[model samples]
Target: MIGDKPAPPVKKTRARRPKVKTGCKTCKLRGVKCDEAKPICRRCISTGRTCDGYGIWGGGGNAYGSVSRITNSSRSPSSLPLTTITTTTITTSTCTPGPLTSTRTLPPLLGATTQHEHRAFEYFFHRTSRKLPGIFDSPFWSTLVFQASACDPAVLHALIALGAVDLGKATRELACAAERVRGYERVALVQYNKAIVSLGVHFRRGGGDARRVALITCMLFICIELLRERFKTAKTHLGNGLKLLGEMRRGEGGRKRGGELVVNTELESVDDYLVEAFTRFNIHSSLFGQDNILLYTIAPHPSCADHAIPRAFTTFRIARLYLDTLINAIYNLAHQVASLSPASPIPKHYTNTQSHLRSSLDQWLKAFQTSLPTLTTHHPLIAPLVTPLLHTYYTMSTITLSTSLSPRDELIYDSHTAAFESMISLMRGVFETILSAHAPLGDEIPDPPGFTADMGFIPPLFFVVLKCRDRVVRREALELLDGAPHREGLWDGIMAGGVGRRVVEIEEGGSWGDEKGQGEVVVPG
Candidate 1:
C-alpha cells in the first residue's frame, strides 16, 4: 500500500505574496506590483499599463488616484502616500473583470455671486484665455483652467479676477504696484480676496477636489501677481505650486504623464497641465540667468549628438520645442556649474557636459539654418514671429556654454565674439521682421500688441550687451533691444536696454554708441 517510490519526497515551495487589496484596480486585475503612485502609479506607466486607480475610498484615501485632499489645519493621513503598500483598503474592495469606468466626480458650476462675476467669466472664456497664454500656447490656459473653474468656486473667482485685470497691458504700465489698490484694480482685488476665501472654505469643509482647485487657483494667483509686476509674490506662488507638484510626483515615485492624468477616459489630467505650466514658468525665468534658477545635473554626452539632427525637422513646432529644450539645458548646466564650481574646482563632469551642450547647439544651428524655409509650411506665422527670437537664444546658448566654466573672467567672454555677432544679426532680423509686419500695406499687422510666455529678444540682447566688450556690436544690440516692445515673461526690453546702456556707459567707462569701432576684436591666444 505504501509503494509508489516513496512519493517523490514532497515537493517544497515558497509562500505566495499577499493579495494587494488596497492597490490600484489595474494592478489587481493584471497581478503586478503597484507602485501605488497617486493619480497613477509608476509601475503601470513604465509597463505601459493603464492604472485604473484605486477602488472606493475607505477611511479617507485619495480614491481613484486623484490628489490627496489635505486640510487647512492638518494633513490628510493619506495626503502623501509615501509607500507602495497602502493601509486603507476597503475590507470588501472588489476588482471588476476589466478596468472599471466611473463618472469623474467633478461638481457642476455654481451660480455666480454677481452679474460682474458672470460677465468676467465669459470674458475669460472668450478673450483673456487667448490673450494671456501669448506664444506659450498652453491648454492649461485655453482649456483646463476653465474646466476647473466650472467645478471649483475658488478657481472661478480667480478666473474672474484674472479677466477683470487685463494682463496683456499690465506689463506695459508704470507704478503698477502703487496704482493697483484703486479703480479697476480694486475690482480685481475684491475678486482675488473672494477666491482666497473660497479656497479657505474648501480647506475647512474637507469637501470637493481642493488640491486641483487650489493648484488652478494658485496659477491664477501667479498670473495676477506677474501681471501687476509683483514678481516676488509671483515667484513665491510659483515655488509653492512647484512644491505641491513635487509632493504629488513623489507620491507617484516621480513619474508623470505628458500633460494628461486620466487613463481610459477623456478627463483632463489637472496635475499634468499644472506641472507643465509651472515648469515652463520656471524655465523661462532662466532667460536672465537668475541666480535662483533650478540647477540640473548635466546629462552624459550622447555618442553621436552632432550627427543626431534629422535631415529636416518635420514641422516648425517640433523644431521650436526641440531647440528650446537644448537652450534650457544649456541654461541649467551654466547655473549648475556656477553654483558648484565656486566652492571647488570646476568638475570634469561639468566640463564634459559643456562640450555635449556645445556640440548639440552646433548641430542645431546647422539643422535650423538648412530648414528655415520649411519653418512656415504648416504654421505660416511661426517663422516670422519666433524664428529670430529663437535664433538669438541659440547664439546666447553658445556664448553661455563657452563662458560657463569661467563666469567671472571678463577675458573668457572675448572668445565668443562671433556668438555676440550672431546675436546682433539675429536682433537685426527680428527688428526688420517686426517693422515689415507694421508696414501698413493696407493689411493687418502680424502679431501686434501681445505678450508671450516664450523668452523673446530681451534676454539675449541684454546678455549680448553685458558680455560682449565690442562696443559697436553691444551698441547695436542695445538699440535693437530698445526699439522692440517688451512683454516676454519677466524680461522687459526697455528695462534691459537701460541696464545694458548703464553697463557700457557707466560701468565700462565707454561713450554711448562707440560707433565706427572695430568689431569682433579677439585678444591674442
Candidate 2:
C-alpha cells in the first residue's frame, strides 16, 4: 500500500539547514550555535561554560572560530599543543577587521618587580639622597647615584636598603611598634646582603666597571654601618674602599708581571667627587684614634698653597683643606714629643718642624681671613654659623699644635689658654646666631636630612670640654654638649658628652691628677 501511495502523488522532501562554520570552543564542542561575543561569549556565559576566546578561521571563511582550529593548522606548525596558545590573536565584530596580537614576557629580576624597583628608586632620589651631607648638594647624589643604580644591581640594592633604613628611622617613633621597625630592618638586611654578594661576584670577575662599582659599594657600606652605629664595620668598609681606589689608580699604567696589559682608565668627574668625599672621611676618621696615615696618602691640592684668596669664600672646602694639613702636622709633632724622654730637651729638628708648621699655619690664617665674607656681602647659601665654626676650628688647630710641642712649656701653655678663650668666644657667637634666628638648639632641633652632631657645633665644643683647663669654658662646653643629642658620623655626641662630664668630675675632684700625674688631662677619642 505504501509503494502504491508514491504513484498516487509525488511528495517533496525537506532540505537541511547549513552547519555553523565558526564559533567559540565551548559552543563548537557542545555542537550548538554560537552568539559570537568579545572576551567572553554570551552563549558560554548563559550556559555556565568558559569561552576559549576568538580567532580567525583557518578554513577560507569570513567568520570567527575557536582558538583550537586556528592554532592547530598544518600551515602554522606550532610547537605548542592545540590546547596551548603561544600567541593570541583577538578579533572584534567591527567592520575594520584585523586581529590584535599579544605575547606575555617575564621581568628582569626574580623577586625585584619593576613597580617595586621604581618605588625604591623614587625613595632614593627624594629621601635617601638627602642623607649625605656634603655629597647631597652635588651631582654625585642627583645624577651619578641614579645612573649607577640603573646599571648596577648591587648599587640598586644598596640604595633601596638605605632608603628602608631611613624610612625606619623616620617612622619608628610614630609606629611605636617594634614589629614594624623590624619589618623594615629585615628588608634592609636582605637587600644589603644581596648587594654584598653581587659586589663580591663582580670583584671576582674583575673589570673596570667592577672596580668602579666596588669602590662605590664600599663607600655606601661605610655609610650604612655608620647609620647603624657599627664603627668597626664602617672602618673596615672604608679601608676596602681605599684599597679599591688605589688599585684603580695603579691599574692606569704599565703591565702586570704576567705580561698582561694594564688598563689605563681616566677618572670621571664623579670619581673626583668620590675622591674628595674619601679625603674628608679619611681626615674625620683620623681624629677618632690618631690614625694619621690617611694624610700622607691624600696630598693637599697645589692650589691650597696659593696666598691669594677669591672674593668670596662660599664653601667650606678650601678651609677644610688647610685645617686638615695643620691637623696632620699636630698629630705628627705630638707623636714625636710623646716618644721623647721626660727630662730630654726639645730636639733641634722638633723645634724646626714646629717653626715651619707654625709659619705655614699663619699663612693659612691670613688666606682664610682674606677669603672670609664681609657682613654686607654674605653668601645667601652659606649658613650664618659657618664662619664662627671655621674660626673656632682655626683657633683649636693652633692650640692643638702648641699643646703638642710640649705639654709643660709655659709659652705653649699660655698660647693654648689664650686660644681656648678665643674658641669659647667664637662658640658663644654661634649660640647667639642660633638664638637670633629663632632656631632650635641642637637637641631641640628636629633631625635634618643629613644631620649629624659633629656636623654642627658639637665636635669643636666637645674638644674644648675635653682639652681646656679653664673651669668656666669647660662648663660652657659641657652645657653645649648637653643641648645636643645627635650622633655624628662615628662620634656619639651623647656618649662622648657623658664621658667628658665624667672626666671633668675626676679632674676637678683631683682623683685623676692623684692617680696619674699633676696637670695631666686624658682626652677621650
Candidate 3:
C-alpha cells in the first residue's frame, strides 16, 4: 500500500535554461558574466583582470596558440610561423590579437598593372636613379620622363623594366643561393619582355612622340644591358638610339619630302635632353672602342661653346660638355693614328688636329683655373670633390693627345712622365679630400638622389697602371684602384682595378721581354 502511494505522488521537475557562453576570455575563464564592452569588458575591468582582445578567432582565442606553446610543440622548428610582433593599442573588443601576420606577397613577375608600375618607379627613383646621378639630377629623369611615362604605356613599361633589373641586381647580390638569384633574374626578364613588346608596338605605330619614347627606351635598354655586362647588346642599343636621334634631326627640318614625323608632331625639351644624354654616352663609349663612327655622325651642340665658368665653380655640368667635345676629337685622331700602316709617315692633318686640340684644351684650362678661386670662398664641398677630377681629366686629355701624336719609334717619354706626375698629384688630392670627408671608398658609399661620385678618375688611373713607366706611380695608382670598388656607367672599378693589377704582375714578371725597359707598353682596349 506505501510503495503504490509513493509512485502516485511523484512531482514534475522544471526545465533549466542552457548556460550562456558570453564574456571576454578573462571573464569567461573566471566563470563571471561580462558586459561585452567595446574595448575592455566592464566585468574584467571591475574585477581588475587584463582583457585579452578578440582576433580572427572569437573570444580572444589564439588560433595558432601561444608562442610558448608553439615553440614547445613536437613540430620541427622550421615549421613554425614566421611571426613579427609590433606593439599596437587595442581600442575595441573586435581588435585582432598580438602582432600582425604578413600576408602581402611579392607581386607576380608577369604582372603589368598600374600598381606594379608605381612600385617599379619608386624602386628606380630611390635606388637605380643614383647610379646615374648627373642625368637624374636634370629635369628629364626627375620630372619630364616621369610625366611622359604616366600617359605613355611604352615608356612606363621601359621604366618599369629598368627598375626591375636594378631590383634584381640588388636582390641577387644579397641572395646566398643560386636559385634565389635565378628567381630575381626571372622577374627582371619578365618585366624586360613586357617593355620590349610595348616598345615594339609604339615603333610600329610611328609618330613623333612614339619615336621620342623609343629613343628614351633604347637608351634605358642600353643601360640595362651594360649593367648586366652584355657589352655587345649594349652597343646594339646604342647604335639604334643614335639612328633614332638622326631620324629625329632630319624630321625637325622637314628634309624628307612627304615624310611625316613619327613619335610626336613637335619636339620638346625632353628631346633635347635625350640628345644630350646620347652625346655623353657616345663620348664615354669611345673611350673603350676604336670606332669614331659616332663622332662623325653626331655633331656637338652649339651650347658646348659656352665655356664661361660659373662664379661658384659648380659649372662642371656645362664644362664637361665642352671637355667631352675636346676628348672626342682627340680620340678620333688617336683612332686615325692607330690605323695608319708602319711605313706611312705621320700625316700633316694629324699634326694639325693635335695642335688644334692642344690649343682648345689650354683655353679650357685657363678658364677653369680662373674659376678656382671662387670655389675657395663659395663652395667648400665643390672645391674638394671637383678640383681633382677636373685636373685628372685635363692631364689625361693631354697625355692621350700627345702620345697618339708621337710616332711609334719616337715615343714622347718626357710628356708622359709629366702627365703621370700631375695625375698622381691630383689623385693624392682626391684621397685627401675623401679622408677629410670620411667617405667610404667606391661603391660602399651611398648614392642618394642627385648625389653621384665622379667616376672620371677611374679610366685615367687604369691608364697609368697599364702605360706609365714609373714603378712608384704605378703602384700608387694600383693601390687607389684596390681601395675603391665602384661602378660608373659601363666602367666597373673593381674589374678595372683587378685587370690593372694583373697587368702589373705581368710587367713585373718580365713577361714583356724587351718592351719592359723601353717604356713601349701597348695596352689592348
After superposition, the stretches of candidate 3 with alpha carbons farther than 4 Å from their true spots are 1-119, 134-139, 173-183, 254-268, 290-292, 296-314, 375-380, 407-410, 431-455, 510-525
- Compare the candidates by lDDT and give the number of the best one: 1
Clashes of each: 2, 0, 9
- 1-525, model 3: which lDDT tens digit per residue? 755645465678866544438755666666666676522355554554445423211122221111111111111124333322122111222222232222121122223344434445556644454445432123345334443443455555666677766655554444254564465466567767777888887778787767877887787787778767676787788878877876776766522212211111111245555665676677667765536345521223333322222323245554554566677667877877988998788889789878877887888787678767864455444557667787788888888888886547334655487789789889878867655755321342233212121245667788788778777888788778655566555566667676776676676785433333333333333
Clashing pairs in 2: none
Worst 10 residues of 3 by lDDT: 66-75
For each candidate in turn, the TM-score is 0.65, 0.64, 0.65
**Between which residue pairs do clashes occur in model 1?**
39-65, 261-269
- For model 2, residues 129-247, the per-residue Cα lDDT tens digits are 64465311333453344445534678768877776676566545553557656766776788899899989888798866678777767767777787777777788877777666656
How many pairs in model 3 have backbone atoms within 3 A of each other, for residues 3 or more apart or on separate chains, i.e. clashes? 9
> In candidate 3, which residue pairs get closer than 3 Å at backbone N, Cα or C atoms, i.e. clash?
207-262, 207-263, 208-262, 208-263, 208-264, 209-263, 209-264, 210-263, 211-263
Tens-place lDDT digits, model 1, residues 220-297: 898777666677787778777766666555466434333211111111344545655665676667665544423211
